[model samples]
Target: MSTIKRDKGLDNTLKVMKEGYLYTTNQRNRLGADNIFETRGLGGKRVLVLSGKKAAETFYDNDKIERKGTLPKRVVNTLFGKGAIHTTTGKKHIDRKALFMSLMTEGNLKHLRELTRNHWYMNTHRMEQMDQINIYRESIILLTKVGTKWAGVQAPEEKIEEIATDMDIMIDSFRGLGTAFKGYRSSVKARRRVEDWLEDQIIQTRKGKIFPPEGTALYEFAHWEDYLGNPMDSRLCAIDLMNTFRPLIAINRFVSFGLLAMHEFPVSREKINNEDDYAYMFSQEVRRFYPFVPFLPAKAKTDFHFDGHKVDKDTMLLLDIYGTMHREDVFENPNEFRPERFLDWDGSPFDLIPQGGGDYYTNHRCAGEWMTVIIMEETMKYFAGRITYDVPEQDLRVDLNSIPGYVKSGFVIENVKENLDRR
Candidate 1:
């Protein structure tokens, strides 16, 4: 329902297109079309995947187009309509994206990259003696802690703990909804809680003069854009940081997924002797195959024709990254895990986007993509090569539910992680 329209109105094709999801030819046609073209996924939708790319382009050029469609106002207030990312056109979308991109510079990302390594250090050492551990719990806390450093906020330790718990609950609400009387509820509760906390902290910061360099992301957001009515709207600023933090640190999940992927393709580990090389190729490949957000839903700013079909204003489109990555047309032997595919025969770099491509327009298109690589690279170096890890055997099922994994016990990389800085 994120981008797949759940509205009462709209035709079948639009609805299906908006859903932007695909299914295997064997399953019942969710669209009722006889020809459910086989896509990169076993349960892949061909039409959805192609439309994903087209919508990104359309939204990128919003001025030339008109975005008049309705969006899920209840979920996301920012980047919702054509004016927002989901429905904007032309220079408007690009300009906003550029503004967001500015926050993620190589210089700024350098600090973030180092921070990622430190986060790993903290989490890895926390369970140095534990035989079996939960990587997700450790990683999520690491992200929250790291995000605070970037935001420049310094709440009490208790406050940080409470806020982190609130955010987790809010995130889980999405998956928890289906079980209650065959209905579902989006978990914005945690978001709201965090917002309230941010409000309190923002007000406190404005009243005081404390802009630390390792400040909270809220400080960055507040100061990034030119001051308008109020020069110190910390709540809005905090929301910006939280929003970006939630998705931006998605690299943490990618780190986990990348480790899991490498576990499958054991030979890939030898390449990690060079951390930089392994980080780039492995993170890129794993992201391409198992993108954190598989399908991206965007709104078209104007009426346009794509792939021989006419799309109306504000039409919802699904970007099928999962299927698209596996497109036989793009990758050679799509299913195989070949990190070398990214490495040119001459070893020159090629364009590979597990994050996204075609103007980089997508809902979960994280701002700190470079940081993702840094974290993954450091993590791989620690476990895959520098430090050996023993991965417990487990079954991996394509968890349609979330970006990470929907398995009973996600992957556990254990071997008493200690002294990672052998370099």
Candidate 2:
């Protein structure tokens, strides 16, 4: 049996927070392990950090690993919400995941695409009248409208804006601590407000006071029965509904990253406009190349041997998402930004996992990942093909030390013009 190398620290929680996306990758490099290593996480709890394709396969295997009770209380409270499908296991997970997957059908995703493009047209017109705009902040507002409308979530414009801002806070605030404690507190408050509104919507839907369409996320979740065949709790239903809207809005981060990629690589921008398949390639690369999800949390379901190392029941594990995608073994010249790499790439779920690695239906892989790709591809087409804008001088660097990092200057653009002929 090969011994797993361990980090020499009492607790590396602070280091994980400070190092952000690179924490486990750096540890794996230092330990000279390709797939597995041991480290102490919060309060010195033994954590097995796993990386690479083989490690992801082991981490996602349901017979070996499970998600229930693995996430910290803080993450549950703010990011995923209590009783989210992300926290379920076994049959409960499949039942809950079914509700999410139903919304990702061919017809449904096509509607989402149209909605995104329509919103982009509005945004482009709005941008034409302004001198300069930051794509990150602007996209938060734009995607918020697209997400709510597509989910059949009806609310006053003001209420939509409020909830959207709160959702943004929830994602941004999840990684902060110590001097950044206020952001975390704000996330709690923001989540509470969003859930309160959603719970009310669920109640109203059930009572027939409001009517969301049959195929919509809000309607389905409000009426969804549990694995035992009881009506889902309104709170749980609300969380499930949020599991739809939140990730849709979260796609704005990838949009920002995509714009950064286009700016950094002008050839990518050109290819997106001229080459029919390049938009898809560029979107895939954006997901693979950037930092979105830092890691995934799970635990051993029972005692098992992984890669000749013994993993006991209830042992905590952290899967290194960012590191695996960038490994030299996974992709040639892994650090370089090139969309062409994906052109010849085999569609291995484990290799390019910005969303996650595994089968979408049977694993914990994100349900909205397909939708994320479509929206990004459309956004790439819109920015590269339908509009002309000038990149002003500013900080384009995305700081890797931050969780879910974005371009520092928010990818600022000026002198925007709409290309009506292209439209």
Candidate 3:
């Protein structure tokens, strides 16, 4: 039996926050290991950190690892909500996941894309007359509008910004625990406010005081029953509904990253607009090249051996999401901003898992991944062809230390003009 190399510390929780996306990757390189390593984290708990394609394969093995009781209370309260599908396991998880998957059908995704196009058109027109636009801020507002409407949740135009702000606050809380004290508190409050509002909407739907369309997310979740054929708790149903739209708003990060990519790699824009396949390739590269989800946490279901190391029952495992995507063995010249790399790439879920790996319905992989792809592809095509804008020089560097990092200057653009050559 081989012993995994361990980080030198009593508890490296603070270092994890300091290093952020590079924490485990740094350890992997320092220890001269491809994937598996041991590190002590918060409260001196031993955590097995793993990365790369094979590591993802092992981390997502449902029989060996489970999500039950793995998520921290703070993360649940601020991000995923108490009863959201992210916190479920076994039969309950499958039943809830199926509800989310039902919304990912081709017809549904097409509708989402149409929404993206219309919203982008109108928003870009509005942006044209402005002095300058912040892609990050504007994307939040626009995507919130799209997300709410798509979910069958009614939000007045004036309230769109408010809802977007709250969602952004919740996501910003991803750096909670050690340093982001203010963000963590704001996230808890923001999540509470949103969840309360959603619960009321669910109540209104049930009482016939309000009606979302038959196939809309609000209608589906409000009416969904559990495995025993019982209606979900109104709060839980609301959480599920929030799950539907919140992730859509979260795509703002990628939108900003995509714009930055366009500015940095200008030639790719022409390819993105002119070639159908290149748009997808560019989006895939954007997901791989940037930081979104830092890592994912799960617990060992039972004692198991992985990569010649023993993992005991109920041990915590951290999957290095950002590191795996940039692994040298997986992606050649992992640091370069290259969309062409994905052109010859084999379609492996584990290799390019910005959202997550494995079967969406069966595993903990994000159900909104289809929505993410559609939105990014549409946004890339739109920005590449439908609009002309000037990227003013600013701090475009992404701070890797932030849990959910973003372009520092928010990808500022000026002199926006709409292209008459419509697609």
Q: Flag regions of model 1 displaced more than 4 Å.
A: 1-71, 77-99, 155-162, 172-186, 214-216, 224-233, 344-356, 360-365, 400-407, 419-423
The Cα error of candidate 2 at residue 111, in Å, is 0.2
> What local distance difference test score does each model get?
0.51, 0.86, 0.89
Task: Give the 10-residue window scoring lowest on summed lDDT in candidate 1.
Answer: 176-185
Query: What's the CA error at residue 274 for candidate 1, in Å?
Result: 3.7
How do the residues 160-217 of candidate 1 rate in per-residue lDDT, one tens digit apiece? 6675655555444333211231212324545666777666666655555555463335
Alpha-carbon RMSD, candidate 1:
6.7
The deviation in Å at residue 37 for candidate 3 is 0.9
Local error of candidate 2 at residue 350 (angstroms)? 1.4
- Candidate 2: stretches off by over 4 Å: 177-180
lDDT of 3 by residue, 181-211 (tens): 7667778899999999899999999999999
In candidate 2, residue 98 scores what lDDT? 83
Q: After superposition, how far is residue 238 of candidate 2 from its true place, in Å?
A: 0.8
Q: Candidate 3's error at 109, in angstroms? A: 0.6
TM-score of 2: 0.96
The C-alpha RMSD of each candidate to the native structure, in angstroms, is 6.7, 1.7, 1.5
For model 3, the stretches where C-alpha displacement exceeds 4 angstroms are: 421-423
Question: How much is the lDDT of residue 22 in candidate 2?
Answer: 90
Q: TM-score for all predictions?
A: 0.74, 0.96, 0.97
